[model samples]
Target: MSLVKESREELNLIPQVMHSLINACVGMFASAYHQAENKKQNLLRTDILTEQFKRLLLRHIRTHKSTSDYAESLNISPAYLNEAVKLTTGFTVGFWIQQATITEAKRLLYTTDTTVKEIAYLLGFTDHAYFSRYFSNAAGHSPTEFRLTHRK
Candidate 1:
């Protein structure tokens, strides 16, 4: 019966307090895990969409250059496709499409003896001048300059 000593009732209540604390800790951990899982799922879905877009671009690049065209083929809205691309690549849909087109143009320039006008037409560019401007803007030089510098 010392003042410092705990009674049987107090000792019984100590286990109850510990159990509540453990439950609270578990609940917090569970909530944190759930949030992390949701973020991972969102990232996975964005990555899948980005991969699909890239495959479609590579296969039908000459025919389908517009963001809306690619999005429509993929059964998604253009805005959503853009959002997913931005999330995965930190670039807009138009930027990716433009880059893909330029990459193909460069490949054709380097690998084939095709003239700039013919290459532009092959890439579905209606105007060779517009293609030249676009190439200069993106590649920092005209297609001729790129071909000369890269030619073996």
Candidate 2:
């Protein structure tokens, strides 16, 4: 009789225990899914910021040459801007700025009849000599040399 009573109690507890385990597993899965969603949202936000930064840099590259200027415009810290840009593009803000400047300088040198000094001034350089040095360092040739080689 006692054995029969104990068996009945054990049988009643089994379904409750199983239900508790199922609830626990469902909770864990839900938590994990939310976390993954949050991570995806964060990544999307960072990507948007990076794209905006690039656009701002291109638009204002001649007038604003520093990362801090873009950062200020975006209302973010310079360090955060650099980190996001680097994470998305595998390069720093300064690298992109230098590349843009050099590419524009090369374009001006190759296409127009603008003198090197005038080109330098147009690109916001205060001194043409420093611009020539900067162009040579990034482009592997001075502005005049590049023009002579690339021009017909």
Candidate 3:
């Protein structure tokens, strides 16, 4: 039957039947709407999470050696957090971590006469050669070449 016929099936159909259905639907909709509002009030944005990730990363760069360890401290899978970091901040988690590492590398290069090998270990590279390669790729100059050219 058509919806109109179905609703009128009791044969006493008039304003009362229409009123009951409208009220029922409105009640359920109101309950769902309020639940959604409450959820919105309770949750933080992904951007806030990204900011927290940056702060934790800076702390780790100062004190630790690994992104894997940092992600563990934040209680999230590194891969999942990396994806969120990319989406919200327009940079991979690795990208920021690498930037922080490279920044420190640059600081030590310019401000101190520390050997590149020493700076590499201080920044947590397992091998001096690998640090040289990684630093060259990131800064577009070998660590020594960069220091020679850029230092004041």
Candidate 4:
């Protein structure tokens, strides 16, 4: 009887978790589409486009880290992407990608018990050492150190 109850609880939990995940995914897609539309509504609105790009980049940085990839997704030329991002934000698209990657890495480090290598991989980094260097360059500390200092 106790085993049956436990099985029921486990089964209920799975659907709840799946429901939450599905909702989150739907929210993310909605946000991305909204950002893309804002960019399209005004070609001269480079600042708005750049801001929208940042939102999109933050949501998809793990999968789309390259400027050219983002450009292609937006149906724009790489040079145009770079120009708009730089003109409005004073930073290139690559810079935004690096910043977004580093931000996500920090969030994962502080929020999860993942190892540095795992966090690097989670952030779409191909090489752990390269991630370490990148983090150190932008964050002023290594991933392990940042995790240790910021962990609550």
TM-score of each: 0.70, 0.71, 0.67, 0.67
| The candidate that achieves the highest TM-score relative to the unseen native structure | 2
Q: What is the lDDT of every predicted structure here?
A: 0.93, 0.92, 0.84, 0.88
Off by over 4 Å in 3: 1-43, 62-66
Model 1 misplaced stretches (Cα beyond 4 Å) = 1-43
Quote the RMSD, in angstroms, for model 4: 16.7
Residue-by-residue lDDT tens digits, candidate 4, 1-152: 99999999999899899999999999999999999997777667577667778788977888887888888877788888899999987889998898889888989998889999998888888999999999999999999999888874
Candidate 3 global Cα RMSD: 11.9
lDDT tens digits, residues 1-152, model 2?
99999999999999999999999999999999999998877776669889999899789878878889999999999999999999999999999999999989988988899999999999999999999999999989899999999997
Residue 42 lDDT (model 4): 62
Q: What is the lDDT of residue 144 in candidate 4?
A: 92
Which parts of model 2 have CA positions greater than 4 angstroms off?
1-43
lDDT of 1: 0.93
| TM-score between model 1 and native | 0.70
lDDT score for candidate 2 against the true structure: 0.92
Candidate 4 worst ten-residue window by lDDT: 40-49
> Model 3 over residues 84-113: C-alpha lDDT tens digits?
788897988878888998999999999999
Q: Rank the candidates by TM-score, best first.
A: 2, 1, 4, 3
Model 3: how far residue 15 lies from native, Å? 59
Which structure is stronger by TM-score: 3 or 4?
4
